[model samples]
Target: MSSASLKRLAVAVVAAAGAFALAMPTASATPARDNVKDKAEVIGKGKEKEKTVPVRLLSINDLHGNLEPPTGSSGRIADETGTVVDGVGGAAYLATYVKQYKNKDTVLVAAGDLIGASPLLSAAYHDEPTVEFLDMLGLSTSSAGNHEFDEGYTELKRIMKGGCHPVDGCSPAGKWKGSKFDFIAANVLDKKNKHALAPFYLEKINGEKVAFIGLVTATTPSIVTASGIAGLKFTEEVAAANRTSKFLAKRGVKAQVVLVHEGDQVTPNQSPDACPVVPGLGSRIANGLDAEVDLVISGHSHQAYICKVNDPKGNPRVFTQGSSFGRVLTQIDFQIDKNTGDIVRSSVVADNHVVRRTVTPDAQTVAFIDLWKSRTSAVANKPIGRITADMPNTASASGEVPLGNLIADAQLEGTKTGGNAQIALMNPGGIRAGLTYAGSSAGEGDGVVTYGEAFTVQPFNNLMQVVTLTGAQLKLLLEQQWVGGPNNQAFTKILQPSSNFTYTYSTSAAWGTKVSNIKIDGQPVTDAQTIRVAANNFLVGGGDAFAAFTSGTDLWSGPLDIDAFAAYLGAHSPVAPPVANHITVIP
Candidate 1:
């Protein structure tokens, strides 16, 4: 299909999807947390003897819609053993545990990325199938993630509404048969109205008042397209949570927990069997917390660990982020008190269970998943194509990687109006999974790329859009990689470009001034000529605050990066590039 036609298809689907898929729940009609009593809507002013009022708090993050098991990372990680972790993640297996443990007092929660930036199995149907599956899994509430903005607030609203249908877009909200989980976005305020899209939510568990405050990281604007979130204001996560806590307090609720799409850094010595102090982005939020919050469930950067964390304030706060891809279930069982309308006290327990698909899919949950999986089976199980070899998402410990190169090439080639530009830039974060090579060792053109492999790298369904930029604009694009200020203490994974283009820079250079030596096809990168560039529409629109790139000319209408790569791989299926990958990050 022509790029223009694909662009039209993308636009029409978005708008049409908006109408049905993006529909939001009116306050009163939104489904209550699953298993909470239907008629016991409002609790009485006072109820005592709330001893042992156990509320099974179940949390999952970065599910990324891997309905099947996922291959995990191997290496040294924050306070955690970094090694080749086993490939043990699958929603089917996750379903088994969740369903097996279902009871009257359980509350299942997801921090975010429950949708968006997902495998073709789920993203293919615009993530509705995943939503359907989540509904079956009993998702009581979910926070927003940066990837949620990948498709914009509109489509997210659709996934929540059950689908964007009448066409193949979204399924009807009614198809959910009345699920009360609210897609909460406490920090996401309306730019026009200066109000929130959806604020703090209260879930009455065991007749005890519990509130969930959902917020993505404050850095959302710098990572997602401003246009998609144009009318919304993403305030600071801490401030937003604080604001919501006050509101919940006013509503006569006390026990509260934060469901964040961020993680933190921890030491390898935190635990012997497990990383006691989990490390990195999302998990770190609990390091400094304040307020009467009891627990926090964090995610977004896909890693796993547990700790008796303290919130922004010095009070005790137990936070956990189960690794993404159904690798583990972070469990924090709580003891509630109805009289106090809060958690009088709490204890924590966490384990990263391997979601082995080989295990018998739980009977009831599998039945639920089976029904929907069957409905979505047409695409869910359909092979996009196959690989003759293994593809690993490995960037050697030194950070250079062939997988990154292959994807960059795919995007560069896929987006072109059919020219030989010899340049493709890919953000490392987009590469989702590693494809397993068929043979044990690597040699020759022994491995191949599959449709699944392509999907893993460019899973967001972000279309590959080509643009034109001057040397200055290209330089600006390269410079936006570091984030925050040079001296800023905030931790971040610098943006990795998808192409072979390399830049020499001083890691010691001040932030915002770090990139230099722009090169193309192995020569000094220049500013005098116009260079054709490729990126997901999000990045093209200044997503990640790369306003300079968005300033360039849109050379041609784009196709979802994954689809483009899929077509590219399909036309030339077994794409096993030379093992000596192109990415070279020099300090």
Candidate 2:
């Protein structure tokens, strides 16, 4: 059938099936008991059984909706020789690489963050294009990353099951068919249902059953917006994996792999293919998992590494992460013993391959991408404002960056009318990209900032909120940036304060005493004084583990963050990077 006709048929089916048609099960969603028996096809019953069956696992993580090729630092990758290569990632090129490496025995998977924090080409349409692209590429399964909860669990369900968005309705391409791949999150329990969203997916390759168990980080609640995960519970990763592994074993399936959305950062100069011996969250989880799990695929730190960590049983297991934004693909080749239904640990060979731009682009992906680009070009290309110079997202010694300052100032300005806002705080994690003085892939002149460019920087579109907080509470909030705080962030998350708010911190000071010399509008802040502060909805709801924001009162919501940022740039044309002196750090 022609593409248009196929779309029409899909729309018709959706219309006839109603809004929840996608929620219905497909052949892939067979019941667990039946799935095990049906998929566990025992091969070679004789004593001289077949030696082994080769299986290839291809995986990617943290895609973040770069349907088109990313540019600048986001698109660059380093080869084994430590030389950097650029202009590498785009759906077209990535599809080409997947096709080159894929075979009938290959199973494709992802470690999540596939759609959130996306660029305009995908985000403008609510990431439907990305889901479609993944379907076309034949993704079998994936773990739920923290960003997957950005839009809340209900929206995530819509993304998985075919249906028009409850709020945004159907896309221009017609009804959504959800994703062909199953999104398994064994650790994320639905409070209402008391079960996992989709716990584990069992796939049979070469007559051998392999179970893929998925889990997001236990800290998911702290990183994602509180409201998005209000009805869910994130359990400890190691415990969750162990439980799932044991459950699979009971069902006569011994070959198990974990697709988790947590990872560690290797040494700065480490090559993408290097298997570092470093210890971090990923390594710790790997070391703690049940011995039945043979391989672990991870992401969320956006770093690349392939480490062989010993499990609790003192067996060496593979733990790997592919860098974010389609820059790398992790390939694992192993053999499953026909006699035992377990992986041959010695046969496991894993490597991270760069998705190079040298290959011929896939024609289908190019056409799909071009169609969306043209549809979004009008709003994406329209100039929002001009910048005098590049305002990169690079943080200063104090963890304050120019773009963060600009966003905080914008929030303060945007909320002033409705909120009597005094100071605005921007989370460093919310800033996705930098605004270059020259145009980006959206194609505009030098210094021109397009709507698409601004969208890329603040992709969350969180509502701007102004809340009332006492000076004492504000101080506690600042102190929460340390390591032992509620956030549990490994590094200090120095909040980017508006220009009017200034403070000094000492690295050597005790946790609660690190921040001092606080002032707003040139006046010393007194503990008893009440202040109206502006922040995104995520912040006010205690996202990124800033639980202190939850104590604020008299909340006032304003425009979307991206709109506020665009308006700020327009009002202040020829905008230059702000000075990095707002935050002071001392040894």
Candidate 3:
């Protein structure tokens, strides 16, 4: 090991204590300028003393274009004590926090998922408002998350490069200006050219170089709609980041931070800030990182954590994630050596701050959100239907969720009239948010589900497709939920079935035999039986690793999934969360 590696090890040992300090509760909505020290430090008393520059990095992830304060569980985050705090995020609150923490040397960045699956105010304008929000926040750079590819690689380029939407033309807000910040992906490459979309971003702070290497999870292909990401290849996270770090090192840039769009969760009941270890891709990437790589800022699991993970040289390193939906922001402070221009690894300190609504929201951000809301309010505020209670997207042990079932039932009902659909299934991921009976901040009143609310739940606007699949193919589709199934899924992803269709699975059963007792309308489905199934086109294209859907015949396309959901809610006023008994799991 080099002298630098040995020194890092000693510093890491001391940083362990600072890592624990992150768990202490923060004062609600405390201004960053009040708490942070922005000055550089000079160590040693003699002429040998070296000066170091201080840099503050502020990060958030999975904002998902939430211009307004997210509602329900999405709006809350748990403290180290496991106590949940509510009313945490909104564009204004986030802006206030960012502004408070920002200094001349401060860099505001995002891990990924800044948009896509957005609120109607932003999504209606193809997330232009959200991009404008980021630019206004002065975000320096961000990695592209899986959701970034929702519309496809070409659309992502347009989002970063800026132009009027090819399909929607320019929104009422006016001509679209491209993002001011850099959107980079080190791992995602053009298959034909084998070149990254935007490899890495460089920032000069206080006459020192700080490099940010951006990467998305390789599993992106499995999770995202296949066609949207066509011609792009997502490489493994660790390898991509390490390779980029090496490239930067060769160029005399060594103060490196990886902004990766993949992460792991804190252990259950563990304080996100206090956990010493975590399990998942985030931890793996952090631990595997080269000694030259100073820190890892991650997202995707959407858990708030400020933890220390050992790098390859066994030197402790800061690894952190801010919880999703702008509810939390991770603050990382470090010193860069004046002579070496590399991060003082031991000087790294990280903490996760909740975007508490207690603070006065930034007036500019409030006006910005309201302006977009006005542009979309005519259709957004229209009452689509009523809901009896919250239909949360939270899934049961069997992976069946009330909202998922509701969406599947809606798709079945919508397609049955013209397409003659017998069964409907919905992917759990496609159900972004849930139906809440309480009124939104828009003042639509309780039990009234507005067009905006429905759009938030089903923002993909995926077209509904009804197709004929034999019972054998349906069984195969069910089996695909497990690890040994088609495409070798990393984990189980139980498909949500409509009320009329039911199935049972066993946890102990091996592979293809894990599922059985499939039925439609109380009748057993035989292998030779042909069933008409309804689902979004993304599923029919074999997204989420459910390849069986690709074999379906007699395909017929119909209404947008959101339209079906709205129509169903209209037909059944005050709709209730459907019983989550469509799927059963036996031990």
- Which is the leading candidate under TM-score? 2
Q: Whose lDDT is higher: candidate 1's or candidate 2's? A: 2
lDDT of each: 0.61, 0.83, 0.81
Worst 10 residues of 3 by lDDT: 28-37
* Model 1 alpha-carbon miss at residue 200, Å: 2.4
Q: Quote the positional error of residue 452 for candidate 2 in Å.
A: 0.8
Tens-place lDDT digits, model 3, residues 515-580: 899999999999999999999998998888888999999999999999999999999987877888
**Most accurate candidate by lDDT:** 2
Candidate 1 matches the true fold with a TM-score of: 0.79
How large an RMSD does model 2 have?
Answer: 6.7
Off by over 4 Å in 1: 1-52, 72-87, 166-180, 194-196, 265-289, 311-313, 346-359, 364-388, 418-422, 438-453, 483-500, 505-517, 571-573, 579-587
lDDT for 119 in candidate 3 is: 84
Off by over 4 Å in 3: 1-50, 276-278, 484-486
- Against the hidden reference, what TM-scores do the models get? 0.79, 0.91, 0.90
Tens digits of per-residue lDDT for model 1 on 1-587? 23333233223322231332122223322322321222132234553432546677777888776765555352112223444334455677788777766677778888887877777656666666677688778787788787777767665665555434445643522343323465676667664433334554556565566777788887787677665576777776776677556555654557888888887654432321254553555544565444577887788766666666655555666767776777666666767664566775544445554444556766765565456545645543334444565556666543545666666666777765653344666666667766665521212223444454456566766666777888887876666665553323244333444556666555667766666777777777677878888777666766655667667774565667777666766676656643543433455
